[model samples]
Target: MAPAQYLLAVRRLRADETTPVPTGAIAAELDRSPAAATEMADRLAERGLVEHEPYEGVVLTEEGDERADRLARTYEILCRFCRDVLCIDDYEAEASALVGTVSADVAERLAEVLLTDEKAPSP
Candidate 1:
């Protein structure tokens, strides 16, 4: 989850650009120490999910980008469910939803229901 979140953050920061994302930027986004962010980045790089260059920051590999996007969408869907269906607060919804795993198919179904249900809150 941490890796996916990091990738999503980097992807958001690099939207419409291919420039490498700075470690400091990632650390700031994740609210982690620079050293911790770098360590995680290194692990991701080892798995071929990202390319981490010392002092040059990191860039998500193709696989990482796709997974990150999926994770972000799943998170959004869960958050919406929590907010509209369960009446959870925004902050709690986001945090609570991510703490548990939700499969892509389940998330898609939830999103479909949210979109089609008359009583669902506006997206």
Candidate 2:
């Protein structure tokens, strides 16, 4: 799973990433097992993406926050593309499901198209 999921959960639980967010809460938010959440949290910490507290929870490291923010932006762009461009009914959900799966190149291309479309004069 993408580390951004954990970051998003923490942000959803509370905006501030400095505060500890319990692993159980994360598991519940992501609908995964506690062990899985812990495992991912540990992996994130190893990558300097997050700080996993043994019993308490995890905190988003500075790098984690930046990644999360970037992911958020990408998600929004994807949502707009799916909705306004592709006419998908469940754009937000589709975008949310694509958080980590979409390639950066694809995301950039989508963003470019979105920008271009927005700038284009209406037909």
Candidate 3:
């Protein structure tokens, strides 16, 4: 949702400059326009989260990668919860519902609880 989703896409698709993720690819992933992806990329560049080359592609900066990794992990945890708790069969359903709704802090807390619960010895 919003710019943060784009950051996650960039990190998941291309975390390194050696293999940049194309705007077209990002657009496809986000179900947005190429222009939309490029614009978001530009915005992210301004924040020093990514390097966007018009023709080359976009790659996440170190900070961007770290942030994106956190977002991606949060999403995965949410997805797992959806499947295991809510019994949602479609991941997209979970994604579309949870995207933008959850905050980083909430996500991290949820992750800690879920992971801790998962690791608790089943007595």
Candidate 4:
């Protein structure tokens, strides 16, 4: 899946745990248009990330849960790196910029160091 789509899937799956999120909810949360949200939902459903319950709501499958967990962890590590080590004031922007470019090896190394160094100042 494309990175944006992957992030959308993760966000939708996360919403499911907290509330019965409709497609519109996803769109609003992501600041995407309704059509885009519908399209994203269709793609995610095709990939088994979610199941459509007709008029009910969407629910995340086990595969979606695993993927979202991994993505969330990666995002958290990037946020820590940008805010703690790099001393970036705009952590969200910096972290988003790094998410797609950072290699898994580098992310792991950063995660290791960040995990070990708990005293780093929070942004």
lDDT of each: 0.74, 0.77, 0.75, 0.63
Better of 2 and 4 by lDDT: 2
Q: For residues 6-116, what per-residue lDDT tens digits would candidate 1 score against the true structure?
A: 777777777444678988899997788999889988999998988898998888889888777777777767777777777777744474337236777787787777656
TM per model?
Answer: 0.81, 0.80, 0.79, 0.71
Model 2 residue 56 lDDT score? 86
Off by over 4 Å in 1: 15-17, 91-100, 118-123
RMSD of each: 3.4, 4.3, 4.2, 4.3
| Worst lDDT 10-window in candidate 4 | 1-10
Ranking, TM-score, top scorer first = 1, 2, 3, 4
Instruction: Arrange candidates, best lDDT first.
Output: 2, 3, 1, 4
Please list the residue runs of candidate 3 whose C-alpha ends up more than 4 Å from where it truly belongs after superposition. Answer: 15-17, 96-100, 112-117, 120-123
* Candidate 2 residue lDDT tens string, 1-123: 566667767656754657788888999988999999999889988999888889988888888877777777767777878888889999987887887788656777777766576642211
Candidate 4, 1-123: lDDT as tens digits? 244444534464454464444766666766677667667767778888876554444566678766655555566688888887779999976666566566556777786676566642221
Which runs in model 4 stand beyond 4 Å of their true positions?
1-19, 54-56, 97-106, 119-123
Top candidate when judged by lDDT against the true structure: 2
* Residues 10-119 of candidate 3: C-alpha lDDT, one tens digit per residue: 87677555688999999999899999999989999999988888987888888887777666766777776676666788975575457557876776666567656564
Please estimate how well model 3 matches the true structure, expressed as its whole-model Cα lDDT. 0.75
On the 0 to 100 scale, the lDDT of residue 91 in model 4 is 93
At residue 98, candidate 1 shows an lDDT of 72
Clashing residue pairs, backbone N/CA/C < 3 A, model 3 = none
